[model samples]
Target: MAPVTNGRVLFNAIPEDYPVPGKTVVYDTTETIDFENVPLNGGILIKVLLLSLDPYMRGRLRAPEIESYMPAFPLGEPLTGGGIGVVLRSENDAVKAGTHVRGWLAHQQYYIAPNLSMLEVIDRDSKLDWSVYIGAAGMPGETAFAGWREYSEAKKGEVAFITTGAGPVGSMVIQIAKQDGVKVIASAGSEEKVKFMREIGADVVFNYKTTDVREVLKKEGPIDIYWDNVGGDTLDAAMEFAAKHSRFIECGQISGYNQGYQPMKNPGLIFAKCMHFHGFLLAVLRPKHSAAFQAEVVPKLVSGEYKFTEDISHGLDKVGDVLLAIQKGTNKGKAIVRVADE
Candidate 1:
């Protein structure tokens, strides 16, 4: 037997304000990953096939000393996020060799996930593409699902507004709301993305980059529900036009992901209009939606009734660039790293 080595992307330095590829992310060509040293308890060794890069992972790149809802990526260690893989070996009876799985697997070719509780085996008969588990059918799908089901509980026929509507989560949010009979007005960064939003059933899609989002929302909506993805100025504008007794799901603030959290200047809208606002993250919501998502959402995904977009770049070496591109909104839909072929 030969000594095995795994390539991985490590979190090198915590950014002061923004992440620089060479400075914040370091790619190691020959990181040692001893295959013989398997998980001691009910664990599994995952052969990572596809990895999803979502904006939430950016928040996890903080210094070790800081504490937040999610643990920060430690310096000089492999970065971990939601990804799809196949089990190569397992001490856990729940998972077996060749089982397709999804979990917080590291940015590596092979990883021993010591905690089986954190990993989930994909449904064998679901007929979804492997990358879908990490993209539309996975966390991003669940995030959009949970946000609407929980926070933005707008009834059918309501006018819904979604920010960053072309991104994975927001795009799903747009579709889900449409399915529920809501008339959706969504915002995207580019014309291509705006077209994508309309293609996915958004009633009106505006290019927030060129259009006055505030003016458009005012003209198109006295919005009943607002699902915000990029918070900053867009949120401020949404607040002005939010309908009385409306619901606001604060799903993400990607604009502030690299710049650090920014304060909402027009928060007084909550009190003035008697509106409801909820700060949301899908981490906890995932478990609650996992069963329903598989039962309800997976079928639609497989049937092509519901569509998803993913920008997949190949190889372990491209992880840093892929992530940076996602943060920059250069990639459309869900950003995935195709580490291996199915």
Candidate 2:
């Protein structure tokens, strides 16, 4: 109804270590997006509702010269990643005002979606919350599905260990394992997260903050699968007692994302344990495996069989701070910023 002045977070500089708000992740306002004007020739204007703050985003905070699976966030550009948005105005027949969408959107109050192909116009009739698309029901959920089902091939009655167990992906791994009758040992940084892991059906949970990770893991684990999220000493311990022919799903390594690559103290166990360690991209399995993930997990979520929690901070201005908290592993659940109301 009125002209919209969008506010967005910009990738100001590459952080040498953890992101420093206003320095590495700067908050800046931008020119108002004219609702009457079409973006990307015939694209739509969207009002971002919820912004997903994920661990993978930390990798993009690096300097541009360094190469990774995805390109580093370019200097002085608006930061972009997965976000939940609502169409404000549309130029295409397929999209219209008031439609909910999930896609790669800037950490801004409003942005232009140049292509609907990169986005999924969510079924408005569904009872699911818009924020769910950015968290467990989104990429992280798909990651858990592919990691445990397609990659790990873990069987019932097997023992598995998941690091950073309170986070979305790791939590899903715990639920999926239990659903398939596998025993899961979950580890997290704090007492609160440890409790969350247990609530989400982790058979055994450990607080890495207090426990000797190596000793505890070696004692509780002859683990058949290690769904790794944090890499460093935790990985070393998983390696030490890995069961024969065990699968190690190398997921997000949050511990090393901010700090430079920290080598494992006992990488030699890869050979001695005969473990299958492979990294994977969930994007590779999109559309095909997406349905299976929804069909399998969404019902459980709705039925309260699969419990989850979300930590939402209000406003678009806090995008940088939330990302910082996610990097530090302080957010108890899915770290998200609610930018606008749906």
* Residue range 179-234, candidate 1, lDDT tens digits: 89999999988899998998999998999889999789879988999998888888
Every model: Cα RMSD to truth = 1.8, 1.6
Clashing pairs in 1: none
- What's the residue-level lDDT of 300 in candidate 2? 76
Write model 2 residue lDDT over 164-279, tens digit each, in one string.
88998999888989988888999988999999999988998989889887777667779999998988777878888789888999997777887776798876777787878988
RMSD of 1: 1.8
- Candidate 2, residue 47: the lDDT equals 87
Best by TM-score: 2
> Who wins the lDDT comparison?
1
lDDT, residue 124, model 1: 47
